[model samples]
Target: MSFVSEFRSFIAKGNVVDLAVGIIIGGAFTGIVNSLVNDVVMPVVSVVVGGIDFSNYFFPLNSAVTATTLDAAKEQGAVFAYGKFLTVIINFLILAWIIFLMVKGVNKLRAAEEKKPVEAAPAPPPADIALLSEIRDLLKNR
Candidate 1:
């Protein structure tokens, strides 16, 4: 096969198409999760934790940097951004939890579908054999 045809064939496969669709949906889902974390959850957490913005929390590595915010601190010198890391870790945990719940629900639905009862098909003997068996029984009775 030609290179172009081979490439086309590979892309036309169901698994590859499904994988591409999954990647697109996953990217969109990530955006939603990020918004939920940054806009909603973090705000509530900040309120509960004395209204401190974790993104602005960082340690200056050098005395030259006297900035209070993380952005200014970075501009002044090297700094450890553990607070931002913590925020990111929180986002990851929330995303993982949402995915876990979704997977669990899907698994439950699949289990329910699998648990459905299936009727078994019945098999009948040949008419000649059945007749022979009946005759034998009648003769034995006589």
Candidate 2:
């Protein structure tokens, strides 16, 4: 087969289809986790901690920079964004944990499926055994 045909075949394979589905699902899952962290978790954290806002949680390297919020600092052309980096790290950890749990669940289901016993077909009597039975019947007839 030509290169193009071979490539098309590879893409149409079951593993490739499964991988595409996984990527789509993973994207959707990421959106959910992002919403949870930004809306639910951050709001609660803001209420409890009272002063720690991950978005605004940055140290201004430039002493001349007098911006109250990280965004404002960035707007004024400031550098060194530790807060955004920290938030990204936290988000990555949460996403990884959720994905890990999902994979673990899938693995468990696969294992259970594999553990199911497969029934075998019954074996037929050998030709020699059949012939012996025929000979016995013939002797009885005699």
Candidate 3:
């Protein structure tokens, strides 16, 4: 087969298509999780921690770096941005928790499905077999 045709066949496979769809969805989900962390959860956490913006919290490596915000600190000199790291850690934890819950729910559903009893209905005999049985019964009656 031609290279183009082989590539086309590979792309047409179910697993490849499913992986592509999963990547697209995962990207969108990452955006939502980022928003949840940056906007909603972080804001509440900020309120609890005396309204300090964690993004702005950092330790300047240089004495000349006197800027308050993380951006300005980076502009002046190198600094340890532990606050941003903390925020990212929190984000990862939340995402992991959500994924864990989703997995747990799916497992529960699978368990429930497994618990269901499957009844197999008996199949009818073929026409010739049925006729032969009927003839044998008639002869027995005689």
What's the TM-score of each model vs. the native? 0.75, 0.75, 0.76
**Which candidate number has the best TM-score?**
3
For 10-62, candidate 1 gives per-residue lDDT tens digits of: 99999999999989998999999888888998889999999989888898888
- Clashes per prediction? 0, 0, 0
Model 3 error, position 55 (Å): 1.1
lDDT of each prediction vs. the true structure?
A: 0.92, 0.84, 0.93
Cα lDDT tens digits, model 2, 1-142, are: 9999999999999999999998999899888888888878777877898858878877777777789888788877766888667667877889999879988999999999999998888786799998999999999999
Write down the RMSD of candidate 2 (Cα, Å).
6.1
Residue-level lDDT tens digits of model 3 in 1-142: 9999999999999999999997998889889999999999999999998998898879999899999899999999999999999889998999899889998999999999999999878898999999999999999999
Which 10 successive residues of model 1 have the least lDDT summed? Answer: 117-126
Distance from true position, residue 132, model 2, in Å?
Answer: 15
Stretches of model 1 off by over 4 angstroms after superposition: 1-3, 119-142
**Which segments of model 3 are wrong by more than 4 Å?**
1-6, 126-142
Pairs of residues clashing in candidate 3? none
**Better by lDDT, candidate 2 or 1:** 1
Candidate with more favorable, higher TM-score: 2 or 3: 3
